[model samples]
Target: MSRTLFIIDVQNDFTEGGALGVEGGAAVAAGITEYLAEHGEAYDLVVASRDWHHADDDNGGHFATDAAPDFVTTWPKHCMAGTPGAEYHPALDTSRVDVHIRKGQGVPAYSIFEGTDDAGASIGEVLTQHGITDVDVVGIATDYCVRASALDALEHGQHVRVLRDLVAGVAPESSEAALAELGHAGAAIVESGALPTAGAGAPEDGDGEAGTAGDRA
Candidate 1:
């Protein structure tokens, strides 16, 4: 069974000091870059996703046009297409990414599943085409895009694991809630360190030791 590394939204807008910055966002980006640098060969494929929204439009009400905006459903503009905010964080080594998926063209698309690769291939299509049965997810804003991507992966029938150390969230409470939801939905939450070496324990999060991300329960 082949495995895929799903890097979600490590974009500039999601990192610290950016428009929609999270506290640990920059750390997550650098951590993921370092992880891939060392363990790039651990997975069969590496797919990265970004929020490439339209600059002019409201993005189907995803962005808040009024003064008072609901942070949950509506947000201040960020990650607009062709902008620096939409690009991956400078720390993230995108050269290692096998496929890049851009989502949120003119709508609210949080999941990487919403995006399509350079060849117009969707995430699900690429996974199926490559025979990817297991997926490990990592990136910024765990409570939002990362959470959405992981849940969708489980729904798509892929064995899903979220690497906690490689993810940063908007809020600690929401991030914890998201992880709980993922666990309840059958997605394993694990630390990146628990990923398997050659022929050792399989690269699955469920079998890892205590204190890993899956033990959040």
Candidate 2:
């Protein structure tokens, strides 16, 4: 089987010290780096998604401008296009990444596959061209971009797996919901340690129930 690894939004802006930091986000980068160091060669393809937004764009102004109503609670300006915040987290090992897919450049794109080049080919299309079949997803904010990308992968008929240990979330409740949604959508959820080898055929949380972290309010 052709296997691929999709590292989603492990950008500096989402890490612990960045503009819209998620708790434990830096740990996700460390964990994925360790995984890649050991098993990077097992995957046929390795791809990464980045949130590259322009500084003067609507996405940037949404938080600063008073004209628009505050949506999503008006997050701090982050991941602006071509800026350091928009780059991958420093701890990430990009040596294994075969393709770099830049998302959220034009609009507020959460899904990695949502962005398309002038030729109309999506990141998914690019992966398909490279013979990627099974995909393992990891990285920041499990409740948002990671979840959206995994769902999109499933919708495109690719077998998907979420590296549970290699992801952190902005909100505990939303993390639980994303996990449940991923399981419902037929995604296998496993820890990063089991990736690319031991847990390939393991059954997911087949109970089809959402689970919340105990500390979540």
Q: Please name the candidate that would achieve the greatest TM-score relative to the true structure.
A: 1
The Cα local distance difference test for each model comes to: 0.85, 0.77
Please report how far candidate 1 places residue 135 from its true position, in Å: 0.4
Instruction: Itemize residue pairs with steric clashes in candidate 1.
Output: none
lDDT value, residue 33 of candidate 2: 92
lDDT per residue for candidate 2 within 20-102, as digits (tens), equals: 88888888888889988877877888888888877885673444456544536455577888899998998998988888887
User: lDDT tens string, model 1, 107-161?
Assistant: 9999999999988999999999999999989987788899899989999999888
**Candidate 1 lDDT trough over 10 residues, lowest sum:** 208-217
Candidate 1 TM-score, C-alpha based: 0.93
Q: Which runs of model 1 end up more than 4 angstroms from their true locations? A: 198-204, 209-217
Cα lDDT for residue 36, candidate 1? 85
The collision pairs in model 2 are: 53-81
